[model samples]
Target: MSRFPTTPDLDRLFRPRSVAIAGASTNVDSPGHDYVQAIKNMGFAGPIYPLNRSADEVAGLKAYAALTDAPGEVDLVISCLPAGAVLDLVDQCGKKGVRFLHLFTGRFSETGDDEAADLERQIAASAAAKGVRILGPNGMGLYHPGGGLSFRPDLPVAAGTVAFLSQSGNNAVEVITRGNARGMKFGKVANYGNGLDVTPGEMLRYLADDTETTVIGAYVEGVPDGRGFYEGLAAAAAKKPVIIHKAGRTQAGARSAASHTAALAGTAELWSTVLKQAGAHEARNQEQLLDLMLGADMLPSSGGRNIAIVGGGGGRSVQSADAAEENGFTVVPLPDDVRRRVREKAPGLADWVGNPVDQSILAGSGLSSNGLLELMLESAAYDLAIANVGEDWFFGRPDASDRLKHACNRLAQICETSAKPVAVVLGATETNNREHRAIVDEVRDDFAARGIPVYPSVERAAFALGRLAGG
Candidate 1:
């Protein structure tokens, strides 16, 4: 009964039978030429028509003078021409029966010029009347992981559960780059620069029903239609999680947003209320936004707020407590029975068995490989357990390294057994200690592979866990 398209429109953009580049050129540095090459580089398996009046060929592909002159039917038309020339191209696309139009030209309403705004409205009107779907007038076009359409020339497309939409082109690039570094792949990414025709609401509606996407993340400076945006988000959140980062929090940020996307920043309280009602998580900043999105995309949806912090250092425990409190998570202390078990298993050193349980007491204990892990698993008070092992030297206890690995594996097994979630926090110096760093990296990698989120900072780990708990 959903009114939105259940399937993604990527077939028209990424896997089109035929594509016509209205402003295609031979100059590699030009935007049109660069885009054409980027599509080819991403392994697009479709016929490409270079529509250049002067050039005989573009990047060795034969050039056609017009979309009509192309050898076959065109599913997509990519326009990288001057802003003034784009309207005519849109008209041409309608005549050619093109279903997808990607406009890379910039001088739309985003420039804040009256003339440019009028032109954008005109183009949208024309496209709507002709039943053509337009992407952007000042946007990053599109990225479809399955069909390998990446607007970014530097990075290859990576398929993931998170679908991202940004209002700023540069912010989209930053998110993609940073997300890639953090092992967060994207199913589809689009920048609705001015959002002349295709708005965030439309994108959300499209992605909400996408089977390939499990989470939706967005960066918004403003919304053209607040009610529509809320409706779309509410509908989407009913099915999957939606995390958003609003940029214009301050007066200066508001002005910057206006200039960047011609967005009219609304009252913060209104935005917050709307987002809360829609069940969308509001992120404070870019890093937190990505953190929340990654957690939502990667973690299970059933965990509660009870968190057990297992780390070597007392400072880590304190930091984790502070972060948990800030994020509205309860840091449950180890029960008396659990503390007694840890002491019994680790009698070689002094034990401080409390909430944010310091596992360092077993640092030099000649305990079995499963000593600390056994203590944690026996304690049923904690819904989620976070283990923070400092360095490799601490793993020197009898089978301690194996114990730590076994503990992590067992924690995941416990989660599977109890239907709860467990995450690990690996805190170690990133530089000036290659050997120790390598050991920490290996442990972190192992934990991540088992569906346990790992973080370098205790705060980050706690934050991710809190978000997972819907805090």
Candidate 2:
């Protein structure tokens, strides 16, 4: 019934027994240095060799003059050398029987240099002859925390259910960092730039059946093989929900994508149709991409498009309704039974409260927002629920700490057994006030630890939920 019953095994390429860093340097500021730092810091066992002719030691690893001189079999090679030097290095990699070569070096076809294009072709030819897998000629390589792998030292080392493949290295870093703030953990990520050999489609096919991956997110600026990617997307969607951000929609944007990754960005309208057909959610930007990544895995598959909004004032409620409806969700009013339950339980606010249950009305009314949240969960009238933190109002009060803690803890507890996808809306990341930021961060951490998905705003939460709701 499904296209891909099994996916490719990329273990040796990722979980190498021995890894060599080509062009590895002791320069703390360089990408070469970051690679070595990440490897050693992650406690990656086995032989770790740094191949650099000029350096005596690179990030504390014993420096080898070259790959040929390195002791033992080199399973993986991460090249951080200049693009001009990669062709010669590719031949050396083949000679040394290296199974994989990950290139952090750029200046290839993306540069639009004729000489650079020829060098990229040579890399492909050399790798093919030796049966060596090339990750990228201009890429950030791999980021798998469980395997003690990463291109940058700052990324999260704790792995989780989400796995992502990004064509742009910077976008990869942004997605990982931003997703981390929202309590997102990742299983694997790859910044496969200028994809000379290891195409985005292949990574998709691999992740489609990856046991560690339950949810998948992808950011692509371009791809050479449209049919291959579509097939991969369809197959992956059959096994798990796949969310994608297809960049380079505009003519100017396509030119930019080409220059950045040497990608052939297809038409936007066509991409929209293709993604919908493939059962993939098309993320307009990287932020929404993170939302899909978290919601797709954390929320259940049966989440309906009908959303019941609670919390926020008149303006926020209107905004939430608009956001939900705009994203293809129905923001329904409080059903008759739920209203009845609220009336009996807390009769004072029955007349004032409605959909988007304005928290301001319930003050000193003996009714709690948590109680309303629970009532929504119990009622069959609502398919999904949104709980707004109303952080700005809470923090403005002198008794901010007690009020914030009580509300967050209560909502966190209620969401523990929620059958429906109950989303909590909190304020955005605070930068100016350290004290306020810490308080919000603590609340977010609590919700994350308890396995509840939290969003910065109702709009974002609604958009994320809408995508998961099959919009």
Q: What overall lDDT goes with each candidate model? A: 0.73, 0.84
lDDT for model 2, please: 0.84
- lDDT tens per residue, model 1, 132-153: 8887778877776666676766
Candidate 2 residue lDDT tens string, 1-471: 233346665787768999999988888998889999988876677789999898888887789999998989999999999877887888888899998999988888899999888888888887899888998878998888878888888777787878889999889999988887677888788888988877777778888878888989999998877777887888888899899999999999999999999998989999999999998889998778888888886777644677777777677878888887897887677888888888897888777787777777888888777788888778876788888988877878888988899988988888878888888898876659788888998999888877788998888998888778742
C-alpha RMSD by candidate, in order = 3.8, 2.4
lDDT of 1 at 397: 56
- Where does candidate 1 stray beyond 4 Å? 1-15, 336-344, 347-352, 367-379, 392-419, 427-452
Q: Looking at model 1, which ten-residue stretch has the lowest summed lDDT?
A: 1-10
For candidate 2, list the clashing residue pairs, or say none: none
* Candidate 1, pairs of clashing residues: 333-355
As a whole number from 0 to 100, the lDDT of residue 75 in candidate 1 is 90
The window of 10 residues in a row where model 2 has the poorest summed lDDT is 1-10
lDDT of model 1, residue 20: 78
Segments of candidate 2 deviating more than 4 angstroms: 1-6, 54-56, 429-437
